[model samples]
Target: MRWAGRGTEPEAVERFYAVIPAGGIGSRLWPLSRADAPKFLHDLTGSGQTLLKETWDRLSPIAGDDRVMVVCGRAHRAAVEEQLPKLEDRNVVLESEGKDSSAAIGLAAAILEHREPGVIIGSFAADHVIGDQRRFRQAVVEAVAVADAGYIATIGILPSEPAIGFGYIEGGQKLDVPGTTAAYAVTRFVEKPDLATAREYVESGRYLWNGGMFIARADALLDEMAKTKPQLVAGLRRLAAAWDTPERGVVVDEEWPRLEKIAIDYSVAEPAAAAGRLAVVVGEFPWDDVGDFASIAKLQSGGRGSDLAILGEHARVLADSSSGIVVTDRDRLITLIGVENIVVVDTEDALLVTTSEHAQRVKSVVDALKLSGRTDVL
Candidate 1:
């Protein structure tokens, strides 16, 4: 991880573009994170800005307003634009349907590469809460340098705990890069392991949590993908050729569905790692996907994980010798009396009551809602 203080002014990262793949309803966040209104569209962190807007605020300085692009489903095109008014309409890469990260990110890379040959583009999830923008930008700058050195660069978060919820990246053979961020060739990417394995991974010191930030030259990213998914790359190129033209909709309708529905990790990253073409830049700045209510609790608590986090007009929820998380919309008064480690989410059509310990199971609740045909509340 690159350790540094926040700078006075962040300089624009030259030749570096950013793509935010704003897809996926955070199901674990349930009642709040609905299909039409996802968590990214709300201020889950109680930061007075939606997660997407926060992401833009942190990234725009580095990539510039014009250079930062958003790849989102057509359903979210309006929300993305509404949150980031400075973003150009042409920069919003609208997907007719969800085709996962590879299509979204790959198409962005294809268009950027076609427009400007060697621009370094980074794909960061729009919903991620990244603290310490100075350090994040510094790490990104280092990642760009690593990418310029002809390697697929990724940011790996330094593991703070034996987290079994995220993937792990093993750093091997440090690269000789004269830089601040520690750059290393990724030995392998491991999936979320068991609790015991996660503990071992944390203890090993060679492993870092996969923060899922990929930065590389647009051509280099596609060239690497060409090695494994050549046809996907070809389809993306065709789509890119029509990206800025009047035929964008026609081309997207014709080819987007046919393009591979795999993730960038499978389409390019993992393969590149195996071929010794992937590097991981250590990331130390605070980051979180806000995967569940537990995650939201942490973000809302101002880093004091044990504090009772109340989001959205906390004054309405009365607490009497109780501690936990309570999220309300001011529709009704909620009285929590002698309740410990409890979570209460009150929405118009749905309410979720669970403890932080059971927050991970919220996705199961969402799944059940879908199975029971109660998706309207979902």
Candidate 2:
């Protein structure tokens, strides 16, 4: 984003801490995404950088490298560190086990709050794709302004279609929030609706796609979380107190697994919206969470020369009147003939074959593997 003044930073970014919660082993994008090396570690968008690196490139200018923090699972520690070599040892916090979103983000907030009381922190998902950096940063500045006003602020994407894959944010009245072009009061957050309901929401013009982006002061987030989940707040506070000390390992191992396992939406966001403590800034940028193979196909880089969307080398695939998305993870050539709307993932060990219509159900294949004790593939 261009600044009005010469050599100046964006508004409210001095104290803004961009906390990246890099958890979750993407199961739907499995075979390519695994427990040891998740999707964030790979270049899913065909960009030179990985998803996590792209996330850094977006926020580092606003939050600086010193204020950026990453939280991830213990298993992916070496990989994350290798990707982010400049990240400080104290900035990257590792969890002993995956305790869901609430624990991962809340722990990061508590630790930052211990260092600086009431610091502005924004949490962005690691695997989302943003097409417009200028519009996204503009929304971030507005969200930080809303956070300064003591509301748990979120940057909701303006819907381009009636997409049922993402949750919806209902906006209420517009408020004259300081340091913002426009801010709206969030009425409530709704889960992914069916096709008919999603269409109704889009037609009503009262809904925005929830991209899981949240920004607020550390104290405000913790205090709001305390109302619904006091036990989680207490345990996180204990762990935060010992985070910068030598006892960090001992405290995390002892209190981390015992913390409440829940998503931040249930723990703070939904309740805060009901009480009028949540606000939203509309993001004009094109965004996607990259959840399934269909989204992958759409985000794939190509000029529509054919119906095929390939994520790797064109030489890897030799198609004959076949149209689908092919993700080449190995050096072997993949040949297809007379295929339509198909999703083919070729890897070294496992391969995923399905259609775009059934891409969302790929997680059930992982479930079946678990049920049959086929941990080798998962």
Candidate 3:
């Protein structure tokens, strides 16, 4: 596998444009990352920078402002507008409704296709956290170069641990292509595995975490889409044809609801892999999807301490609060004397107390609350 480092130069990249698909409601990270404010807007890293801002910062050097586009749902228009003041009002493509990743990418692709031909596109989720931004950027730069050569490419994360939360890519053998630093022919893409299977994948040394990062020319993607999932591609093509027309953007909002909800991974990458048409590039950069609260617990002190006061553990008395996450709601005293493995969320009107282990299942509670018509709790 190929590893990347800061400022490590690769082959010159193609004309690059980035599409960030951020339509998720983030029900899993409820108290902090709500439907109104998803995980991308929150400071999950404890670094004071939001996930989308960090992603924008890392990608800015390569694609720059004019080429960077954000695809978010209508519910988050104001929040996105407030956060990214530099972006033009039109650059933010507001989905009339939230369908899924397939529709989001299709919308972004339609925009890019109209803007420029032979454009290399890097589409990624906004909430994922990449540790080595420079290396990550370098790896993307390399992937763009590979894409320019007419192959659908994705950045496959080298499995650092037996992570059950992530999908894995198998059958990634090193390639001997010219001017290629590290490209692999993807044998297959596996969905999330059981613990035993995950352990085997990590130990096998032939698997990589499917980090859900994709790169390819817009035309190449459309071509693959046409070949693999023609119905979805046809709908997107119709959308692309009418994206810029005055009547389309303002009046054709109804058509989007009819669009199929599919993921780029399922519709494009998996088929390509099965047909031996997909290229998986080994990425050296550290990555995480940051899906739910359990991941949050892992990020904070490896979820070890109950009395693990994040901001001020040593200064104050934090006794018998072992295995509790004491996130202060206000600038008040947060002394947890007796708590264990609970997530203490301090929101304005809501306070959630959930065990760290079952934090990922919080979305079910949110769904149930919605079913009960209790918008007050949600």
Best by TM-score: 2
TM per candidate: 0.94, 0.96, 0.89
Number of the predicted model whose lDDT against the real structure is largest: 2
lDDT of 1 by residue, 203-289 (tens): 999999888899998999999988888999999999999988999889888897798788888888789999899999999887887
In terms of lDDT, model 1 sits at 0.85
Q: How many backbone clashes does candidate 3 have?
A: 4
Q: Per-residue alpha-carbon lDDT of model 3 for 96-202, expressed as tens digits?
A: 87868877886677668767877888898888888887668767877887787777888889887898889999856676555568788899999999889999998
Residue-pair clashes per candidate, as listed?
A: 0, 0, 4
Candidate 1, run of 10 with poorest lDDT: 1-10
Candidate 1, superposed: residue stretches over 4 Å from native: 1-12
Clashing residue pairs in candidate 1 (N, C-alpha, C atoms within 3 angstroms): none
**Overall lDDT per candidate, in order of appearance:** 0.85, 0.88, 0.75
lDDT of 2 by residue, 1-378 (tens): 223331354456667999999998889998888988798887888887889999988887777777789999888888888887767788898988888888889999999999998789999998889999888888998899899988999999999889889999999999788778768999999999999999999999999999999999999999999999999999999999999999988987789779989999999999999999999999988899999888888677342424888886543788999877898767688899999878999888898999888999999998999899999988
